[model samples]
Target: MIELKSPGEIERMAVTGQFVGGLLGELSGVAAVGVNLMDLEHHARRRIKERGAESCYWDYAPSFGNGPFRHVLCLSVNDAVLHGLPHDYVLRDGDLLSIDMAVGIDGWVADSAVSVVVGTADPADLKLIEATEVALEAGIEAGRPGNRLGDISAAIGAVARRYGYKVNGEFGGHGLGRTMHEAPHIYNDGRPGRGMKLEPGLTIAIEPWFCATTDKIKFDNDGWTIRSADGSRTAHSEHTIAITETGPRVLTRRPEPGEGAASQIKQAAANS
Candidate 1:
C-alpha cells in the first residue's frame, strides 16, 4: 500500500533529509586522490554518532544485497555504480565515486546519493555525473501533486536520452519513510500520464542513474556491489522529496554549495 505522510511526519522527514544532505556534502568535499574509502566510512560513522541518528544500511538485509550491510557508506568507484562496499582501496586522480547514504532521525528516514570525480576529472566522467544530476532535478520538477508517477519517470528518461545514456530499469528510486525502502517502486523510464496518480502528502525518493554504454549490469564478487556490464563508467543522483498541495518540496536541499545540509540538522542537534 502507498503510505501518505502526515504534515508533522513530513516535517520530521525534512530534518532527516537535511542531515543526509549535509553528510553527503561533507563526504564529497573530503573525497580526493589518496584518500582511502575506509576513511569516508569512519567520517560518516562519526557524524551519525554525533547527531544521534541511526544508519539504515548498516543492518539492512535485502535479497539482492549481502546480509546486513555492515558499512556506513556505499563507495562506488569508477565502474562500480551502486551499493559499492567500502574496502581498503584508495582513491586515485580522475576516479569517479558515487556515495549513497540513508539515516534515521526521530524514527523518520531520508535517503540520497551523489557522484563525484576526484582531483583532475575526465571530461566524459564529468558529463556523466552532470547528466545524472540534471535528470534528478527534472524528475523532482515533475513530482508535483496531480501528476502521475510516470510524469516524473518520463522526465528523467528524457534527460538521459538527450545525454546519450541508457537507463537501468532494474534499480531506481522508491518510497521512503520510517524504513529505508518502501512501496510505489519508481522507475527511471516510463510513459507519461500513466502509473499511479501523484497526490499531496506523498514523499518519494527520485534517483537517476545511467551508464555510457549498455543498460545491463553485473554484480561484484562482494555480493553487495553492482556495476555496468560493459565496464563503462556510471553516475547516480538522488533526493527525497514531498508532494504537497502547492508543489514538490525538496527536503534534502543543502544550504549552500559545499556547506552541507546545515540549516535544520545542526539546529535540531543543538536543541536535542
Candidate 2:
C-alpha cells in the first residue's frame, strides 16, 4: 500500500536526509585517485556509526542479490551502475565513480547517490554525469501535487534523450521512507499523464541512471553489481523528495561547499 507522511514525519525525514546528503558530500571530496574502494566504504561506516544512523544496505537480503549485503555503500565504478559491491580496487585517474547510500535516523530513511570522476576527468564523462544530475532535477520538479507519477518519469526520460543517453528502466527509483524500498515503483522512462496521481506527503526517490551506449544492463559475477551490457560508461544521480502543498521539497539535498547542515535544516523547516 502507498503511505503518506505527516508534517512531523516529514520533518523527521528531513533530518535523516541532511545526514545522508552531508555524508555523500564528504565522500565525494574523499574520493581521489589511488584511494582504495574499501577505504571509502570504511569511512562511510565510521561516519554512520558516529552519527548513530543505521545503514539501510547492511544485511539487506533482496530476492535477487546474494544472501545479504554486508557493506554500507554502493560504490559503482565506470560501466557499473546500481547495487555496486565494493571490492579491493584502487582508483585510477579518469575513473568515473558513483556512490549510493541510504541511512535511517530516528526511524526515518533517506537515500541519495552521486557520480564523480576521480583525479583528471574526461570531458565526455563529466557531461554524462551532468546529464544524470539535470535529469534528477527534472524528475524532482515533476513531483508536485496533481501531477501523475509518470510525469516524473517522462521528464527524466526527456532529459536523457536530450543528452543522447539511453536509460535503463529495470532498476529506477521507488517510494522510500521508514524503509529503503516501498510501494509505487518508479521507472526511468514512461509516458506522461499516466500512473498514480501525486498527492501531498508522498515521498519518493527519483533516480536517473544512464549509459553512454545501450539501454541494456547485466549483473556481475558477485550477484550484485549492475553494469552496462555493452560495456559503455554510465552515470547515476538520485535524490529523495517529498511532495508538499507548496511544491516538491528535496529532503536529501547536498549542501554547498561552505554550507552547513544547520542551514539545510533551516531551509527544510521553512519549506515545511
Candidate 3:
C-alpha cells in the first residue's frame, strides 16, 4: 500500500536527504583518476557512522540482488549502471562512475544517485550523463501535486528520447520512506495521463537511467552490478522528492559548490 508522509515526517526525511545529497556531491569531488572504488565506499561508511545514520543498502537482500549487500554505497563504473558492488578497482581517466546511496536518519530514509566522469571526460559520456540529469529534473518537475504519476514517468521518457538514449524499463524509481524501496513502482516510460494521481505528502524517488546504445542490460557475475548489454556506456540520476500543495520539493537536492550548510558538510567530508 502507498503511504503518504506527514509534514513532520517529510522534514525528517529531508534531514536524511541532505546527508545523502551532500555525500554524493562530496564523493563526486573525491572520485578522481587512480582513486579506488573501495576508498569511496570506506568514506561513505565513515560518514554514516559519524552521523549516526543507517545505511539502507547494508545487509539489504532484494530478490533481484545478490544476497545481503554489505556496502554502504553502490559504486558502478563505466558500462555498469545500477546496484554496482564496489570492489578493488582503481578509477581510470575518462571512466564514468555512478554512485548510489540511501540512508535512514531518525527513522526516515532518503535515496539518491549521481553519475560522473572520473577525470578526462569523453564527450559522448558527458552527453549521456547530462541526459540522465536532465531527465531526473524533468521527472521531479512533473511530480507536483495533482499531476498523475505517469506525468513524471512520461516527462523522464521524453527527455531520454530527446537525447537519443534508450531507457531500461526494469529498474526505475519507487516510493521511499523509512525504508529503501516502497510501493508505487515508477516506470521510466508511461502514458502521461495514466497511473495513480499525485497527491500532497506523496514522496517518491525519481530516477532516470539510460544507456548510450541499446536498452538491454546484462548482470555481472556478482549478480548485483547491472551493465549495458551492448557494452555501451550508461548513466543514472535520481532524487527523492515530496509532492507538496505548492510543488514538488526535492529532498535530496545536491548542494552546489559554495552553498551554505551543505557545502560546509562537503568540506568537512573532504577534510576527513
Candidate 4:
C-alpha cells in the first residue's frame, strides 16, 4: 500500500537523508582510478557503522534472490547497470562506475546513486555519463507538488533519447521508506500529469539508467549483477526524494552544497 508520512516522520527521514547524502559525498572523495570496488564497500560500511546506521543491502534477499546478498554496496562498473555486486574488481582509467547505497537510520531508509568516470576518460565514455546526469536532472525538475509521476518519466526519457541511449526495460525507480523497495514504480517513460499525483510526505526514488546501445539486458551468473545484453556500457543516476508542500526534497543529494542545478549543468556541459 502507498502510505504517507507524518510531519515528524518527514523530519526523521530528512535526518536519515542527510546522512545518506553525506555518505555519497564521502564515497566520491575516495572514488578514483586504481581503487578496488571491495575497498570502497569497506569504506562505506565503516562510515555507516560509525554513524550507527545499518547497511540495508547487506544480507538482503528479495523474491528473486537466490540467497542473501553478502555485500555492503552495489558497485556497477562500466556495462553493469543496477544490482552490480561488488567483488575483487579494481577500477581502471576511463572506467565509468556507478555506486548505489542505502542505509537504515532510526528505522528510515534513504537511497542514492551516482555515476563517475574514474580517471582520464575517452570522449564517448564521458558523453554517456553526462547524459545520465542530464536525464536525472530533468527527472528531478519534473518532480513537484502538482506534477504527475508520468511527467517525471517523460522528462527523464526525453533526455536519454536525445543522446541515442535506450532505456532498460526491467529496472526503474520505486517507493522507499522503512523497507528498501516499496510501491508505485517510477518508469523511465510515461504520460505527464497521469498516474499518481505528487503529494506531501510521499517519498519516492527517481533513478535514470540507460544502456549505450540496445534496451535489452542480461543478469550475471551470480544472479545479481545486471548488464547490457549487447555488452554496451551503461550509466545510472538516482536520488531519494520526498514530495512536500513547497516542492520535492532530495534525500540522497550530492555532497557539495553548491552541487545544485547550476553547478550540475555546468559540469554536464564541461564533460560534454
The TM-score values for the models, in the order shown, are: 0.94, 0.94, 0.94, 0.91
lDDT (Cα, 0-100) at 97 in candidate 3: 97
> Which candidate number would show the highest lDDT if scored against the true structure?
2
RMSD of each: 4.6, 6.3, 2.9, 6.4
Model 3: how large is the Cα RMSD against the reference? 2.9
The prediction achieving the highest TM-score against the true structure is 3
- Model 1 RMSD, rounded to 1 decimal: 4.6
- Candidate 1: clashing pairs of residues: 22-261
TM-score of 3: 0.94
Instruction: TM-score winner between 1 and 3, please give it.
Output: 3
Better of 2 and 3 by lDDT: 2
Per-residue lDDT over 136-208 for candidate 3, one digit per residue giving the tens place of the 0 to 100 score: 9999989988789899999999999999987889989999897889989999988898999999999999999
Error of 2 at 196 (Å): 0.4
Model 4 lDDT on a 0 to 1 scale = 0.82
What is the lDDT ranking, best to worst? 2, 3, 1, 4
Tens-digit lDDT track of model 1 for 1-272:
88999999999999999999988887887677777788778778888999999999898788887678998889999988999999999889999999999999999999999999999999999999999999999999999899999999999999999999988899999998988888899999999999999999899999899988979999987789999999999899999999998999988875443534333333333353
